[model samples]
Target: MTDTVADVTPEIAPSSYDAAQRRSDAIWQKIESDPSGLRMLTGDRPTGALHIGHYFGSLRNRVRLQQAGVETWVIVADYQVITDREILGDIQGSVRELLTDYLAVGIDPERATIFTHSAVPALNQLMLPFLSLVTQPELERNPTVKAELAAAGKSAMGGLMLTYPVHQAADILFCHGNLVPVGKDQLPHIEQTRVIARRFNERYAGGEEYFPEPDALLSESPTILGLDGENKMSKSLGNTVMLRMDEAETLKKIKKAKTDADRQITYDPEDRPEVANLLTIAAQSTGRTPEDIAEEIGDRGAGTLKIFTAEALNAHLAPLRARRAELEQDPGYLMQVLRTGNERANAEADETLQRVREFMGMVY
Candidate 1:
């Protein structure tokens, strides 16, 4: 781990934490040391409704971290919409709906500040300087950029799409975040941020580490595969289970969900990915081990597993649905949350931008 404070080096270890309690201790320790303020930055692009894959993947952890007293900032990355041409048409509406979903899902404005990428101009300015620091080979190596290029069917990628990792660095460093919650797939982005932060501090902080080398707060949850059991759960793929899905829709999806051909049920992702996907979902939703769920439903047939998984999912989502319904009644309240959060976020971001400008001798 990189040292964020003078003479203080963070410890790096391959954690024993299961999918739930994985990075809690390490995160808490960092927060404890910087109680007055420890910044955390995380966000999603405004594309569509957040699904169960999102809830179980990272948003759930964001709520817990916010409540734990870490200063959290969630950005609605409206600017990233240009990366995927399809989303550009409805990006505005999607941003509004995404904020509504965020409030409904327990991202409290009082506890965490939320803002839109388009609303922050200074943050965007950091991207240009950041681009100069990183090379084309470095950007090309980013896994997400490669995947996105393939997804967009772009044989020759645009410069903006290729340098997204730099934009992500600006997102975190703009807010001076000390910790960022990200999955294994996003580890490279955080790695890039560390390099940028270190380079900036070394060159600009007058020999002092003004910006902390942010640490990755890894999720303990297993990567939630999509309902198709083929790839990661995603809204675009139509394989996601929405967090606010009604009982009927939930059941309908599960009924048609894929499963293994074998008559016997087993939790083997490698050998039987489809069956294992269901078991993983069941385990996560019911707080049971995949093996335990498999044994309990042994020889019951896929129908039984589908029914049970649907019921477990519905039960798990009961509170979130109720909370969402209550929040939906007052859309203005959610807007206010974003408005207030934007103010706070802008204030914090401005502070860092000011420091950066002064360091680079852009202003006296």
Candidate 2:
């Protein structure tokens, strides 16, 4: 919330944190002053349905920027979904669920352009030129690549998997996304985007600058944790309170969520992740701080904390669930939204690719 957006990742270099946080502050301040002109790119991979972690980390910021008249583009990154073969096995179902979550979370079809990545061929074309611009060592050096490999539990990955960040650069630049709202863990990937953009401009455009260097727009909310309290809330991990969960189901999940046995709840993420996770959830749900929530719940037992958390969580998700239900019942309508978004996104992608091809002398 302050200039010091804490880098929760212990492995991140301090210099990296400082540079990213400073740039993030500048981007946030500029956008806050005049959001109308800013173009934003943010979205999910559709590897699975979005959950509370997704909501607090980036989805909420995407909605906020779109509502503020930022030229917002959200991608259901179907291409990225296949980075893991296991994901490719069920991407179709996951894409459907992803669309439902996007609509459920108030990503207005008319406001923010939300499209499937595969729908925009022009964007994908940009990646080929970009791949040559970045080196294998550069890709291997990316912390996000390491993190992804670690998360996927794969020591061996494919060429495409290794160069996925290059694909992301294509995604951001194709839209001229000057503002990329993401959590801290994603800053490294955005940094890679910045690098690729810089390299492309230097190599092809003679550093005159064609693509905007996208900055990480850190959300005001701290990173949301899973119910297990040990890791990030993830659908893959089966620790998520899904965005479109019904009231009763949401409460049931929250009730079963891990919490400390402490009688008096305290907001200590480092020491008490479960209690802190609940407190953070309650804060986001009620527009209060975790510290404030902890104070309000003084002397409250874990049972009371669970009750309050469930109520807050359900209240926040109630309208979203209703919207999701409406959208799910009309699958044809959801597909239409993606199609419309694709049309709009493809127009922009074509323009970007035109410029890029000209720069690369591929205009024949």
Candidate 3:
């Protein structure tokens, strides 16, 4: 990847690209040397079950950080689900499914705190002062927010939607999470969070660092294109293989996945995106380069390539699927894991909130 990492979202200023690269590299180096000293906050909205894209993209990194001994917090962001949409579909089930995926993929709740956004009141409370620190122009300038609004076909941005980045800042700062794993599109959010942290410490704490301005831990994972081969893998599009899917189900999905007409298979993303996407999947599963996978499968055609990719993926995910099945059988255990994490997160949030109140003389 270049200095920009990937095709960055428009909200991130083009000028900040190289700077972000430098900062990301430096933070990653520090993490490698002293992983235990860092705190990381990263999560997803519990909208639905996770898929291969989520696995290889961010979830893998989350587990790696947790195993590396970083104090990790995975917020379900339940409240943010309604930021754009009016309806809240099966949040309870969604949260459970997300937890199952988390555990099945080696995210130890004992090591990483996994909690809901709604459960932590103090975390939400931090959003108030954080909202004050950022200006209206700054909020409107966020490309991700604008893109989301456009995607959702909403002419007017909701209050939560506009201040979404503020909520994110609170999520990170409330727990003193200084290392945030995010892709290029989310880099601007981390930058805005840093601005909020800087302004708060300067204006309220007399420039004495109260919040560690979080750094973006850029993900090196390639964007996993959907089975359609045209768009990014998305559940809504019916083009994803869910993590909970069994080996047979996954193989069936792969068999039906879109592919090119050319018989001679090669890894050329610009030209043969669909075939290359399958190769990428196989490569990620087998820990081999996509180019190597393509070379090995030369002239085998899409049928052979699909079967090869499916087998590799199934082999990689077999253990995770077995673990997920066990977790599903014991619903009580899953809830207990979530409840324990929520309690720990609330305690951490309370301490941070009390200190913030003291800093601003609102401790009455």
Each model's C-alpha lDDT?
Answer: 0.76, 0.80, 0.87
> lDDT per residue, candidate 1, 124-146, as tens digits?
88887777677889888766677
Tell me the tens digit of each residue's lDDT in model 2 across 1-364.
Answer: 1101112342568797788889888877777788766888877776667788878776777777777778878888888766756536687788888888888888888888888889899999998888988888989987777766776678897777788788888888898888887766677778888888898889999878888788887767787788888887766567888887777888888888898768987888889988998898999898888898888789978888889988998888888888888988999988898889999999999998998888989888
Least accurate 10 contiguous residues by lDDT in model 1? 1-10
List model 3 lDDT by residue over 247-318, tens digit each. Answer: 899999999999988888889999989998999999999999999988888888999999999999999999
Better of 1 and 2 by lDDT: 2
- Give me the displacement of residue 178 in model 2, in angstroms: 1.0
Model 2 scores worst on lDDT over the 10 consecutive residues at 1-10
| RMSD (Cα, Å) of model 1 | 6.0
Best by TM-score: 3
TM-score of each: 0.88, 0.93, 0.96
In model 3, the worst 10-residue window by lDDT is: 1-10
True-vs-predicted CA distance for residue 133, candidate 2, Å? 1.0
